[model samples]
Target chain A: MNENRKHDSNAQDRTDRDWDLLYEIRQRVIQSVAKNMDLFGVTPSVGRLYGTMYFHGQPMTLDEMRDELGMSKTSMSTGVRSLQEIHMVYQTWKKGVRKDLYQAEEDWYKTFIELFTTKWRKAIEINSKEVSNAKGLLEHLWQNTHDENLKRIVAEDLEKLQHASEYYDWLSRLVESFETGEIFKFIPKKSEA
Target chain B: MNENRKHDSNAQDRTDRDWDLLYEIRQRVIQSVAKNMDLFGVTPSVGRLYGTMYFHGQPMTLDEMRDELGMSKTSMSTGVRSLQEIHMVYQTWKKGVRKDLYQAEEDWYKTFIELFTTKWRKAIEINSKEVSNAKGLLEHLWQNTHDENLKRIVAEDLEKLQHASEYYDWLSRLVESFETGEIFKFIPKKSEA
Candidate 1:
């Protein structure tokens, strides 16, 4: 009986040590990621929320996430909402809880591409439109220009604008293909048929 | 005398038409670019200031840029200061002008590299550090594990961490070389360059 008791105590002691170490390491990682996100103009809460979802590898309720990330309910709600807006996160209604559960969209590339198209690509499209309008004005002036040197410069700039627009159109088409799950096989296979 | 009068009037008329067209085109391009920038959370004044410098192909004084982009003195001053903070705009003292002239860094790749390293890389570095800590935690847990199945699952996660760290390292290296301009030459030179 004494030998069994000794073994049980040793196991408990070992488990306690392991848990302490794990918590410490996790805290360090969380702190480091938070600092980095701040540098990128991302809120620290956003980083923590992404980091937690990424590490969990499963959907977690807001209360669960709040406990796991050591975040307040308000911070988790706001951060998760922003991440969902950026398409880096998704929400699912669990059967029991009134609160929604969230998960990081596992495919990193797709998440970034979605963000690019929705946010970054819009900017590019605007720039392309501006360039086209600029080309039109330059063309109008070109018709009146007799100077060979000025005409050559204007012509080259117009060509550059055309190329930029063409490239953007091509990229937009390519990205549109990834909107559905077909193109990216990188996503882990869905278990439920 | 009649020939001279006709020629001079025609030249004046053409010049006036060209200036008017240039002004109109310039405004359209500037406005569109500004709108895109606003979508990305950048101010219109800041976007216009950068857009003007980008298309101008050379630096201009606050006065010159104000005249060229048709911005007020107050608008140009505020915009230039904001761009300067982000290192997207650089100021140089002009020989004739009383104040500093601002220029856009012309090399798109180099400017992107600078922005990535200074702003984005910091975030990556923090992520890398967190990944490292996660690695340490996994190692500790792996050593402590008696359940082979649970251990295998955790080991797999650690392996993913290893791969993720490598990716971040590779990205940082790529961005680092970009600042030197050598990376662009190594790749097939884009026509824009």
Candidate 2:
């Protein structure tokens, strides 16, 4: 009976140690993701919370995440909201539970599309507007200018703006393709290549 | 003779107006670029300097650029140095002139490859290191833990890390293909499509 008890205690001790190691590993992953997200100008907490959920491989409660990550409740709420906004995380309802549970979107391809389109499309929109603004001003100048050399330069500038506009349009189409999963058609498969 | 003199004066006035209009357009383009650069976490001055050089479509000396863009010599110098470091601008030596002249790279494809690879590769390098670090810690945990459930969880985490590492490697290869212009092969030609 004493031997059985000793074996049971040893098994319990091993389980405890395993839990400690798992927690340590999760923390390390969270820190790494937080650092990378900061480089991309994203708030670190968003990455940390997402990383924690991803490593846990299960839906986690906000309070669980807050305590595990040592983050304030407000920060946890804000981070989870932003992650959900970006489609990187989603809330899941548990039966008989009032608090919402969240999990990271584990598919990297979906995450890539979300992030790429969000950033590049915004950049394209801003740049396209600016290009049009500059083009308008230059076209007005081109119409009124009488100096031959200045007319030539203005023409060149207008052409550059046109080129930029065309590229932005093409990029917008590409982004649309990504959103629709049509981009996979263009990406040559190794078998076909 | 009096009529000839009047005609010359009128032409000079037109030239002055053209110069004024050109300066205005240049300023607008510079402002647009600076705004976009700020969005990408780059300094406004760097974008301003590059935009000025690109729109000018010719090599410009530091003093000339400073006068045209209304930038301080210090800002121009620093901005130009940074642009050159990124391979977006190149210095040219003018005959019978001591001041260094610089021009923006005219080829968008070359510029795109240089900029995209530089930024993305640096990001990949940093993220890859962090992923590896996380993987290392998890591997150590997996080796030490005797709990079957904990070992299974650790194995899954390790697989995720391996997948991330592989993706980063594939991205680095993609960057290299971009550098080598091999990416063009994958891009569907409109004519063929």
Instruction: State iRMS for model 2.
Output: 4.0
**Residues B78-157, model 2: lDDT tens digits:** 88898888788999987998888999877655665677778777878877887898788888888887788888988998
Instruction: Report, for candidate 1, the interface RMSD.
Output: 7.1
Q: lDDT score, residue A23, model 1?
A: 54
Q: What tens digits encode model 1's per-residue C-alpha lDDT throughout A66-121?
A: 88877798888988898888777898877787878888776644654476456656
**Candidate 2 lDDT by residue in tens digits, A82-155:** 88888889989889988988988887667767887887788788888878988888898888877778888889
TM-score of chain A of 1: 0.67
Best-fitting candidate, measured by TM-score?
2
Candidate 2's displacement at residue B15, Å, is 4.6
The runs of at least 3 residues in candidate 2 whose Cα sits more than 4 Å from the true structure, single-residue gaps closed, are: A1-17, A38-40, A186-193, B1-15, B38-40, B63-72, B129-144, B188-193
Model 1 DockQ reads 0.25
Clashing pairs in 2: none
Model 1 regions more than 4 Å off? A1-17, A34-42, A69-78, A92-99, A109-119, A144-193, B1-21, B35-44, B55-58, B63-87, B91-98, B144-160, B173-193
